[model samples]
Target: MDEFSFCDKSLSYEVRVKDLIDRMTLDEKAGQIGDTALGVPRIGLPKYEWWSEALHGVSDVGQAGNHVTHFDDVIPGATSFPTVILTSATFNQSLWKKIGQAVSTEARAMYNLGHAGLTFWSPNINVVRDPRWGRALETPGEDPFVAGRYAVNYVRGLQDVEGSTEDDEVADLDSRPLKVSACCKHYAAYDVDNWLGVDRYHFDAIVTEQDMMETFQRPFEMCVKEGDVSSVMCSYNKINGIPACADPRLLKDTIRGEWNLRGYIVSDCDSIDVMLDAQKWLNDEPYYCLDLDCGYYYPNYANTSVRMGKVKEAELDSALKNLYNVLMRLGFFDGSPKYEKLGKSDICSHENIELATEAARQGIVLLKNANQTLPLKSNKIKTIAVVGPHANATSAMIGNYAGVPCRFTSPIDGFSKYGKVKYETGCGEVFCKNESLIFPAVRAAKKADATVLVVGLDLTVEAESLDRTDLLLPGYQQQLIQQVSSQSKGPVILVIMSAGGVDISFAKDDPNIQSIIWAGYPGEEGGHAIADIVFGKANPGGRLPLTWFYTNYTDMLPLTSMRLRPIESLDYPGRTYKFYDGPTVYPFGFGLSYTNFTYKLVSSTKTVNVKLNKFQHCRDLNYTEGSYKPPCPAILIEDLKSSCGDYKVKLEIEVKNVGERDGSDVVMVYWSPPQGIAEAPIVDLVGFERVFVGGGGGSVKVGFELDVCKSLGLVDFRGYRLLPSGGGKFVIGDGVLSLPLQINFRR
Candidate 1:
């Protein structure tokens, strides 16, 4: 092996991968296609497992069973941060990266102990297009910009070398050794798992090219181009008529050719099987060059296809090169890792545990704090009642795709730290179908100084393959909350512990329900985090990443309608905060902090001039008569591609904490395109930054620089990005503050 150039650590990954591919036989190349790679042992290449999961922690949920062990003597468990939806609520990119770093650290440590694999299929960056889609818990919510930013930061933290800067250039990624490999998964308009009679495997997502470019495909584009991710897992669903795994337009043309993805394309677990058996995509196409992540028949099929002249050996070599390149980047063939010293001690270290707690604290959204009824003084509140199925939750606190946590702190345990506690499961479970259980919960609430009703959906209510039918609380859970709140001795605090948004407008309008908190599967120390917020130990700053729509909204809207723009003639309200104009239970970016904060626009660019080239077609169009109005013709962004770099919008906003307590506030910037553009969003989030401001009179200045083409541009019906020539407004945080601007196109 030492005589082989592939064994040399100093050689480039490309050269080394090519050498290794040249040495391997046809059978050996086919064997390396699946998740369980059958290495060329004769050439000193050992077998490797390419499948593992680290969504929020070192999880053992992948095809490689128990890869990240918990029962082991040396390492007990990994630090589990809050699930992606909750984490995204924090609106903190730095925190997202930090959590990613912590998870990868434990992953590398586990790898050193030979307890885990280097490649982890994680950070599911699929936008949560619908609330009923069960896996919303795993995504960064409904915004494409947020999801894209999450992919970039989390991927960088997972793949970059331990000491490398977070802002490392994409050009440098190819040469650098990876700490661990991270894959952005379930690509290309894949949000559904199972809905009514339709499941992800069989359902075909009929999406318009405009909606695809504007929303569905934006995150994956960012994941590939900006994140520089090592791998992308095609979804089980079909985009239009073609299965995602088998679609060359998506996998080859878009991801590789256009985005220039410097990585391998792998199918979701058993997605190849789904395509062949369920979708019958293989029978019609008879293509055998697709990449498989996990399946039994790949090697045999590949060997058969190569002999039958169906697939070229060179094409097989090309795919193998990609697979081996990833392994090479992970230092698989380069001997022991540089951080080989990392072991059991690094798995659940104190710092990692603390980070988990902090993550939960930051992501807990305070939906309602009516009349400042929260922050129950521990001294005044002598006896508190912790009632609900999730009151003493153990595994429920950690949503799906979770591993063994380092420890657990139930809601009962957390509130007990402040005062004497009385506990009762309001319902036997989150299902809460039985009315008899509510009596005991109401009795306990009546006897306590304050009642914390920890009620909401669980995995049983919403999880993989379990799409919800309604947006309301399951069964009798809503009744229990109402009963307890109406009869409680003191203020009743409602705590929702689920992934998808609940239409809790009943409780929102109820005076009896003083406060409400959405703790979306806050991992491990979640209970403690919720208690801290309730007791004023931590200020709640998390905003809703996705809008909480009314129950009636789902009644009219079909989950299959992938269009994002509202169709007035059809009365289709559309999807997400970007387009939907209907009433909402809670709008996106809605969260109440313990204190108040105000935003003031300090400075901003009033006009952006896009100088078009001489040969462009749009430059010949006449300008409109009115001031700040668009021209007679629309200007496609492709025509002014070269001039995009010349125009940018820069602004500084001062956020002052006007309340009596210090707290964190997210400064969100939204853009409303020129009014005349057809099918444009109402307003969409462009940039956001979370900052901590001290008590009364304290202020923090936040700055943002947005490209005119990428940030302010509108996607037209033809799927082309168009720079509309007219006046627009940059809305800052909840539409209270805004700056008007004009975009002009000239030759």
Candidate 2:
């Protein structure tokens, strides 16, 4: 096998993969179809496992033996970071990339120890369309732009080549070797896990073309085109009456053909079995003859399908080439890895663990700080009360898709550092079902100088296979919070730890509850991060990635409705911050800081002109005319793509810290369609940046350059991106600052 051309290190990956496939028999090639790829021992190839997970860290949840394990002399764990939902709340893309880099470093170290695989399926780029969806904790947020940006940054960090360009050009990506293969997944409109009577295995997501292109598929496309991810896992559910794995339009045409994905497509674990039993997609004589009547392994079905002419061997070769390409990039066939010496020292280094704590600090949002209630003066507040279900929580701090951590700092442990801490489980657990337990908690709060109520949902109330029925707190939790706050001797500070948004309107309105913090399942150092914000050790700047809706939202809208636009006749109010115009407990991008910041537009382009060819319809229309002339026709942005040369909108805004405390501020810029455009969102986030400013009138300038077609256009009902000829506004930082802009066509 060493004499074969496939073993030549100098050959291109495509050439090597083709040479290897040509040497394999049909059955041998078929053996490579499953998650556990059975390698040909005769050719010196080793078995490869493709099911390892690295969502936020090197997790132990995959079927492959790729997991962090405790041993006598080896490292006991990996650095577990905060969940994706909380990390996205930071609005700091650089930090997201850094976390991904750290995770991949540990993953490579594990691989050297024979405990991990090269391909890590992770950074779930699915948009959290519905807050109640059980897996919301695993997603970026509701906005396609945010999800797309996260996919690009995180995937780049995970699979970074030593000398690759930051732009990730296709040529450079194809020629380079990857540190680790990163996959952006559960591809194409997969949010619901289990809701009411519908389960993910059987549910058919009837998505409209507009929503599919504009919202659902946008992130996956960016993951492929921009991130150059090595793999994409098809979802379990069906999209528009077709199983995602079997749909040629999604897996073949869109992902590979349109976006030019340089990776293989994988199933979402036993999805073939789901297709056979749950979906019942294959019900014929040939399928029945393949040993379904008896007990036949599911992976062997691929072998039978090729012989039955259901799938061609040439197609299998193509898929194998894609898979082998990633393996080659990871140096699996290059004799030995350069970093084979990486081991225990690199697994949970001090720097990695510190980054986890910093991530928790940056992502914890300060929801309310009425009359300067937070930053409890340590000198004055001698005795503090930390009461609630999560005050002493350890495992609950780290959300799902996690590995064991190096250490833990519970809320009680963190607050004890500042002053005397009197702790109590407010009502037995987060459910707060036992009314008897409330009395002891109230007594603890009454004696302390300040009270910190740590309460909210957890994995039991909302997780995989569990969709929340209502947005309110669990049983008696609200009662426990209200009672404890009323009896407390001093100001009450509320700390909520959960993946999904909760209505908590009662606490927001209560004057006794002086401050509120939303720490969305912060990682192992969550307690320390929460304590940092409460005592002014760290200033909170994380914004809400998903909207905090009122209870009436779930009452009016069903979880199954996959619509982004409002239906006036049906009284449907829509979804996400993009299209939703209804009332919210707290809107998207809402958060408070210890210090306040104000924005001033330094410079910006007033208008952008798209030079059009002679065949364009809108080229002759008068775009400058007022109400007298007919409105210029909407033009498809795709047609103008070729003509968009150096046409972009550049803006520079100065941010001034107005308060007397140093803090970080997220500058979010949102773009709105022309006033009269039908079915347009209220506003869409186009660009954002998180900046740190010092106390006492410190200021800095933030710059942004946006492509006209990519950032300013809106998707129409027919799934076409259109740029309307009218006036629009660019809102900055919660509508505090605004700038007018226009788009016009020139022949």
Per-residue lDDT of model 1, residues 1-747, tens digit only = 788989887777888888999998888888988888888889998988888888999887866453433336666678888999999999999999888888998888888877888888988989988888898899999999999999998998898776666466656456557788899988889977778888999999998888888888899999888888988988899888888888888888888889987778888888877888899885742354355557766775787778878778888888888888878878787744577888888888999988988999999999999989988998889999999889999899889888888999889988999999999897888888788989999999999999999989888978888889989898898899899999999989999998889999999999999999999999999989999999999999999999999988888778887877776677888789988887899999999999999998899999987666667656222232443334524577787777778788899999999999999999999999776556678898999999999998899999999988889877766667777777889998888897999877677
Give per-residue lDDT, candidate 2, residue 484.
96
Q: List, residue by residue over 548-666, the lDDT tens digit for candidate 2.
A: 99988888877888888887788888899998888899999999999889899999989877666766665222233343332455677777777655788999999999999999999
Alpha-carbon shift of residue 201 in model 1 (angstroms) = 1.1
Q: Weakest 10 consecutive residues, lDDT, candidate 1?
A: 619-628
Alpha carbon lDDT of each predicted model: 0.85, 0.83
Error of 2 at 221 (Å): 1.1
- Where does candidate 1 clash, by residue pair? none
- What's the residue-level lDDT of 537 in candidate 1? 97
